[model samples]
Target: KLKLSLQEKKCSIEQKDRAISDLSMEIQLKLNEMIHIKTSLSGMSSAKTIIEAQLSAALSQITGKDQHITDINKELTDALTSIVDLKAKITTGEDLRKKLHNKVLELKGNIRVFCRVRPLLADEIVKNGDSDSILHLNILSENSIELLKGTANCDTSSMSGLKSRGNGAVEFTYDRVFGPKHTQADVFEEVSQLVQSALDGYNVCVFAYGQTGSGKTYTMEGVPDSLQDAGIIPRTVTHIFTEIERLKEHGWEYQIETSFLEIYNET
Candidate 1:
């Protein structure tokens, strides 16, 4: 009986030793598993941080690009607006110029005939008591001449030589002849006064009228012999140029044009 009891006690000790070894092996395996899980979690955390950083940087760049595009859009819009305003101003100016031109044409169309008279000689009259050698002055017509002699220093008397009249009806001195004077400026000034009236929205008409023997032709038409006595047509042209120059003194922009026409009656 004593031997049997000792054998049982030894068996109990061996079982306790086997149980301790199994417990130690299980603890080591659980520790290795925990280490692997920790390493994997760390790697995943690092990858997530890098992705988040990349996402944040990409978003910032997109925001900067969006701001640049917004600025470009604003500048383009401002440029377009400025261009539109300039076009509008140009259109208004053109319309104003057209209106002014039309007004000028209207004023010119409403004018009546302006009569210009030629200078006459005082000697053409006959006096009962005067001898043939004595010079006499006569008043011919109601029309009077515009003498520019007071304005210019030119001597008109040098043209006083008598020339053969066209019809031999009368003889006259060149100085006393009915015609335009040598003062080109004075003539232009006189005509500009009339043209300026049109610019002021007034009507005007210019004409020369007289009897057949009178100096009407000499006054209105230019003659080849007298360089100083050019007709009203040339003087009027100079007046227009002068007026254009005068108007330029102001800030107004203007343009000048000329057109000539003749009426021909076809039988």
Candidate 2:
């Protein structure tokens, strides 16, 4: 009976030891699983930190690019404004050039003419009383003359080339035209530009040629006593000397030659 009891006690002790070993193995498995889970969580945290850093770097680069774009836009706007101003200035210059070219073209000619209509003679006023004057001649513009054709107004019959047209009025254009109202000074203003051409080394001639009693002498060799009626010849001589004096300050010198001639009956 004592031996059986001792054997039972020994069996019970072995079973309990085996059970404790099994429990220890299960605990070891659970611990390995926990370690694997912890390793995975650590890797995920490292990846999150790398992703956040990459996103931050990308945002910084975008900000710099946006600032650069803004600067370029401002520069482009300024360039456009400058281009507009340049175009406006160029247009103005071109217009001025065109006007100058047209003026030059108008002044170009070998035989330009200036027609000066003298005041009506005292005898003509007595004979016709201002009737023939208005009927015969009309100053159309500063540079145009209109001569009416044949009427019974025979007072202006001697002024040839004025009565050639047989019917309606004939309009004539000239480089310039002066009415009876214009003063000698007024005539000299336009003629002065021509005198300037001569100063620039150009050959120039100013003369008057017309029928008898047509005021040719009056226009060329005006009343010497009247300063206001002084003719082109005297004004030109004085202007030439005056200009010579003015130009002396610029180291210029001049010589002048003068000639006067009269031809009668095509001689």
Give one digit per residue, the lDDT tens place, for model 1 in 170-267: 32222122222324344444456566665544556665555565554555446755657666666666566776676554434556566665333423
Candidate 2 residue lDDT tens string, 106-180: 566656888988877887766665543655778989889987656455554545555456565678899889998
* Top TM-score model: 2
Give per-residue lDDT, candidate 1, residue 109.
49
Candidate 1, lDDT over the whole model: 0.56
Candidate 2 Cα errors over 4 Å, as ranges:
1-107, 130-133, 150-152, 155-167
User: Candidate 1, 57: how far from true, in Å?
Assistant: 2.2
Q: Estimate the TM-score for candidate 2.
A: 0.54
Candidate 1 runs further than 4 Å off = 1-11, 90-267
Backbone clash tally (model 1): 3
Indicate the worst ten consecutive residues by lDDT in candidate 2: 154-163
Residue 35 shift from truth in candidate 1, angstroms: 2.3
